[model samples]
Structures are given as C-alpha cells and as structure tokens.
Target: MATVFITGESGTGKELCALAIHDNSARATGPFIALNCGAIPQDLLESEVFGHVKGSFTGAISDKPGAATAADGGTLFLDEICEMAPALQTKLLRFLQTSTVQPVGATRPRKVNVRIVCATNQDPLDAVRRGAFREDLYYRLFVVPIHMPPLRDRGEDVIEIAQAALHRFSVEEGRNFAGLSGEVETLFRNHPWPGNVRQLLNVIRHVVVLNDGGLVTLPMLPESLPRSVQPPPAPAAAAPTDPASSGYVLDSLIGRPLAEIERIVIEATLARFDGSVPKAARALELSPSTLYRKIEGWRGA
Candidate 1:
C-alpha cells in the first residue's frame, strides 16, 4: 500500500482526512490504528510502535502488541510525525522498508502487512532541511501529499460548516436555532477564521448554551472573538485600500494626534464587532463603562 502524507494547519481536519483514507482503502474492514508519536515518551516509543515481550522493561508485565502489530492488514496513522525523535525515525524507516515488526525483547522480526498514513502540521521537507526529521523517511512517505486550506479562504464553506455545527451544537444543548442572522452571516464571511472549523464549533457551542432558541444573532456571540472581527465597508469618499489586497497601512498615523489615533482604533474595533461596545471594550482590554464614556465624549466633541 502507498504511504500518504497529510499536511495542514492544526484543526484543519488532518485526522479526519486520515480516517477517510483508511475507510475508503482496500483494508477498510481491518483495524485502523492511530498513534501520536510526539505524545509518547521517547524511551517507550519503540515498544509503543513495535510491541514488547514479557519483562522487556521495568513496566512490561506481559507480552503487548504495539501499534504496528495491532494495525496488521490495515492502516497506521502516525500523527505529529515530524515530532518523532531522529534515532527512532531510523527504526521506523527500516520497518517501512521491510514490512516487519521486531518487538522489544524479541530476538527476531515478524512480517506484517499494513499501510502507513502520516500527518504533520509543519512542512515535512522543511523539517528535513532543518535536520529535525529524517530526509529519507520524509521522501518515503511523501507519496501522497494533501494540503488542507485554512477556513477563511474556502468561500461559502465558512457559512455551510457553521450552519452544520450550529445544528449539531443546538441539538446537543437542547436548544433550537434556525440558522445564522444575515448580519452574523456577513460577519462570519468577512472575518478571518484563524482557528478554522474547530473554532467555529466552540463559538456555536457558546451560542447554543447561552441562548434558548431562534436564529443566531450578534448578541449571542462570545465577547472575546472581537479580535477576529472585520469592520464594515467604509464610505466611498474614504477611498480605502483594495479589498483584494487586504493590506493595512500605518503611514497615516505619523501625522495624527495620539488621542485621534486612539479614537480611530476604538471606532474601527467597535465597527468590527457591529458596534457592540462591550465586546469591543473587552477586546481592547478596556472596561465597558470606559468605552461608553469615550464614545459619548467623541459624540459630545
């Protein structure tokens, strides 16, 4: 079976992709094993991947099968693969080459058939260049490379995923939400979802838990997400930067007064959160009353 490499930003569903590969492949009925190489202690990792015999080490009470033996005739998903120690990587490479397992405290190796699927949030080639990962192994598993794009760049998918998550979370919380309000939809579409689908889920969970029912409105959103908020369209006379460029210029600040700059920043932040002063205040680390007083002062001026 061909080894597959999945690379993407964290929370972009690498594991889900790995599972999909296992499910659709020829070994669909066989056991699909997943192992996080980085999470296990380095000393025990060899045994974790290759099994161990009785009394192999201090904790070895009896013969135990590692992920490799456990995943015989199926797929073994190694996550955070680049985090694996260099020394153990050599052994892994050998195992991949021979299609065999040499359990700890065992004198000989046993043949096993299994497909390898690995994932890393970082660039594996870059890791090899930095000498953090084995170059040979990187190329060995680079047969199939899948890169998952960030949520913001996926067009209407943001809204679609949000709607699905909303329904799921609403049912879990025993609340009913028809869908997102138009303003909330625009807010979601315009904002850069840095945390991707996982972030959308938590936000929906917060919305579901706090509110009883109805469409998801701005007021139901968490106050702390203001940093990711995007401001509304500017006036035509302002002549803002091209939307495609999404570039922010700091040159105009050179000649502006400090108070004016602060006001500008506050107003921009407020607009991003749809004029919700409390959410903006929390994002700017200011008290709500302080934000209120500043806005009143700005209007009074």
Candidate 2:
C-alpha cells in the first residue's frame, strides 16, 4: 500500500531515492530487492521479475523465485523500467493490478505482497506517447511519483557529494591527505559535470588511486574537469567611481552569459590555431573533443 515511483536523469540518485523510501516505510525491517530492468536479457528479464518453474527455459534446472517473490513483505525496486520491452510492460501491469504473478510455465498465479518502487531515466510521458511504454501502466505506477532533481540542478550538492566520495576513497586508499585545496575547489565548482555524482565518485576514486601523498590538487582531477575549468578573469576596475560607467556600461557590453564568454574564448582560440581542434585544445588545455562538444552545445542552444 506504500508504493512509490521515483524518476530522474541517469546518475541523479534514483536508486538512492528508492532505498530512502523503503527505509522510511513501515517495511524497513523487511527485505529490499532491487532489479535493473535493462541489465538482463529480455528473455530472462521476465523470469527474473516473476520467477520461473523448472524447465521454463534452457537455463532453468530448478524452480526459482524471482525478485518480486523474494521481496514479499518488503519493497521491490524496478530500475530503468523504460528499458523493459512493450510486451513485458503489459505483463508487469497485470501483476501490479492483482498483486499476483504467474511464473513462466506455471499453471497458477502466486500472490505477491511487496511494495513496488519503479524508477527510470527516460521520460515516462514521452515513452507513452511513442507507444513504447503503456499509458495504462504509466498511470498505474505514477500514483506517488517523485521526480528526483539531477546534480546539475542541485548546485552546491556537487561539492557535498564530491567531498563525501573523496573522504570515503581516501580512507579506503589509506591516504591521510586533507580534502580538496582552494584551487581544486574552484575547478570543481566551475566544471560542467554532465555525469553528475557518478563522475564525481570516479574522479575521487581516481585521485585516491593516483595520490602520491594525501593532497589532491587540480592536476589530479580528471582531464575532463581540471583542463576544461579555467579560472574566471580578474575584475576590471574594482569599485568604479562612475556608477553609470560601472553598472550600465559593463552590463550592457556583456548581456549574454558566462557560458557565452567561454564559447567566445574557445572560438577565438580555435581560430588563432587555424581551426585545428588539437592545437586549439592544447592551447586551451582542454580535450580536443571536449572543446568541440562545448561549442556544439552552445550552437544548439
């Protein structure tokens, strides 16, 4: 009765949300089973979810209880639900409606008493519109939908997650170093982390692995981060005497955005290097393709 549906972009902590809900619910003492709908083969996916009788398929030597049955009296998390095939979606809907599952090659339906928590990176509405996801199933699972915000939109959470990961990795790596330095903090704040928390985790793990001592400097950061995050220019004429000159004039000249400024800088560097991506990237100390992708994103914007 305490089912929930969590949705978010990849690396946006969808599974974490599901776990949190399960932990908070009355069934905290019960089992919490998680399934990645996209990881297993489609043929085996159904068997994994709804169990299978002996001789259900080639690999089945004996009857096995799937995740749903195993999670009875607890919570069952279905991750990447959009990745499930259309036919399987219908079958899942049937199970959801009746709280019963018919194992493959089984003659009778077995009642399941587990809270369902579904998650997906893909947009459910879009998937429904495309006829890839069942509209009825969408409405069924969306009863208590929770849209988890991505790390990019969470602003300062990036630093929080990074620090946590760094601490965990540092302890694991047996390094006694302090956290990120001021310079590295600046880079961490500026870099557009498209991969979000997972990328931060990877960077922290990498730093721990590459740490000569306990210090994680800007250089220790991934090439995707440190190389791309250049420092902002120094303020020109700090505290201008003329209010008109300081406020309106400066603001008027640069009305676009900081991203636009970066784009211009990259474009200028590319032109100065005669459109040689490698040379321009080297000059800017960014990956050649990273620079190109930034330009492409700007253009598309």
Candidate 3:
C-alpha cells in the first residue's frame, strides 16, 4: 500500500488532514486509528505502536492490538513520527516493508493491510540529516508528500474560517454575535497567524465566551492581539470641499446624532491606535481619564 507524509508547522492541522485522507479513501468504512509518537514515553512507545501480550513488560497486563493491526483494512495515522526513537525505527521499517505486524514479545509477525499516513511538524528530510529520523523510513513513507502552508499564507480564507469558528463557538458558549467588525476583519487579514487555524479557533472561543451579542469590535479583542496585529490603513480622507467641514471627513457624519458621531470618531481613533485608549485620547486632544469616562458612558448607554 502507498503511504502519505504530511509536513507543516504545529497547529496547522496536519493530523486533521491525515484523517481527511483516511475518510475519503476506499477504506473509509474501516478503522481509522491515530497515534502521537512524541507524546508517549520512549520506553513504551514501541509496545504502544506494535502492542504487547500480557506481562510482556511492566504495564502490559493483557493482550493489546497495536495501531497497525487494529487499523487493518483501513488507515494508521502516526503524528510526530519524527520523534520516534532510531532504535525502534528498524522494527517499524520492517513492518512497513512487509504488510505484517509483530507485537512486542510476540513470537511471529501477522499480516495486516493498513495504509500508513504519518505527519510531523518539522521537516522529515532535515530530521534524517540530523540523524533524528531514519533515511530509509523517510523514503518509504514519503510516497505522497503534503506540505500544509501556515494560515498567514492562506489570505482572506482566514476571514471565512474565523467567521465559521465564530458561529460555531457562539452556539457552544451561548453567545450571540452578528459577526466581526470591518476593523476586526482588516486587523485579522493583516495579522501573521503564527499559530494557524487552531489559534484562530481559540481566539474565537475567547471572544464568544467573554462578550455577549453584536459585532466583535477591536476593543473587545484581548490586549495581546493588538500588540501583534495591525489593522489596514483607512482610505485617504476626501479634501475639504467646504471650509466649515474642517480637515475631518464629514460625509458619513452629516445626518447622525452628535452622540453617535462622537462615538464613531472615538472608536475609529481607538482602532487606529490598536485599541489603546491612552494613545487614542492623546490624538483626540482629551485626557486619558476623560476618554475612559466617555467610553464607559457609551458602554452603559
């Protein structure tokens, strides 16, 4: 059977991609088992993958079907395969060479038809060069290579993805949100999402749990976000056609109530300053305390 190898930064959903492959394959109805090699103890890692009979080693109290055997006629997804010890790699390579599984302490190997799909957050070839991963095993499992680009590279897909997460998290947390504000969308688009989709989901979860209804505004975002994320530049203001309009754009403020107009100006300035009220206040020619009082009044109103 052919194998698939996925490489991506952590939180880029490599395992999720592996599962998707398994689900879409001809063996979709069969078992789809996954193992995170790095999470298991080094001593018991072999036994965990290949299984062990009763009393085979310290905690092997009963017979166990390893991932390879249990996933027979289906798929076996090994995450962080690069973390597997070099010594145990031989046994794993042997199993891959022959569609057979030999459990630890077992006398003989048994045949099993399982498609191998493995992933690592690091470069598998680099691991081979560093002697962390076996060269032959790398070649064996790299039949189909999948490189999952980080979220920052995915462009406006982040907007749709965040919205989807927002909707799902909203229902789960019993929070109702219309959607992200235009400023938030611009900020999200400009941000370099180092943590990918997982990070985006976590942020949506945080927002859904903390705030109630309405659009997710810049001020509502966690403070840590503004430091790393910057919003897109606003359109250049139209030249003053009327001397009465001053330097500020008055097109959007014409029919609005004074309170609403003030609120818009304040919030727009806050967004420009990455949600820093201190900086926004300085720009607006008001004391920080005065700005805080006004914002609090708006919240209550």
Q: Name model 2 segments beyond 4 Å from true.
A: 230-301
Cand. 1 Cα-lDDT: 0.82
What does candidate 2's lDDT look like per residue over 157-183, in tens digits? 877888888878778888766777887
Supply the global lDDT for candidate 2.
Answer: 0.78
Off by over 4 Å in 3: 227-301
Q: Write the per-residue lDDT of candidate 3 for residues 1-301, one digit (tens) a residue.
A: 6899987778888888999998898999999999999999989888888888888888788999888889999999999999999988888899898888889889988999999999988657668889999999999998987777667656789999999999988888788899999988988898867678888888888888889979999888877776346543442332345677664567767898998778777877777776666678679876444565565466446
The TM-score between candidate 3 and the true structure equals 0.74
CA lDDT scores, all candidates in order = 0.82, 0.78, 0.82
Q: What's the CA error at residue 267 for candidate 1, in Å?
A: 30
Window of ten residues with lowest summed lDDT in model 1: 231-240
Clashing pairs in 2: 177-214
Pairs in steric clash, model 1 = none
Angstrom error at residue 236, model 2: 24
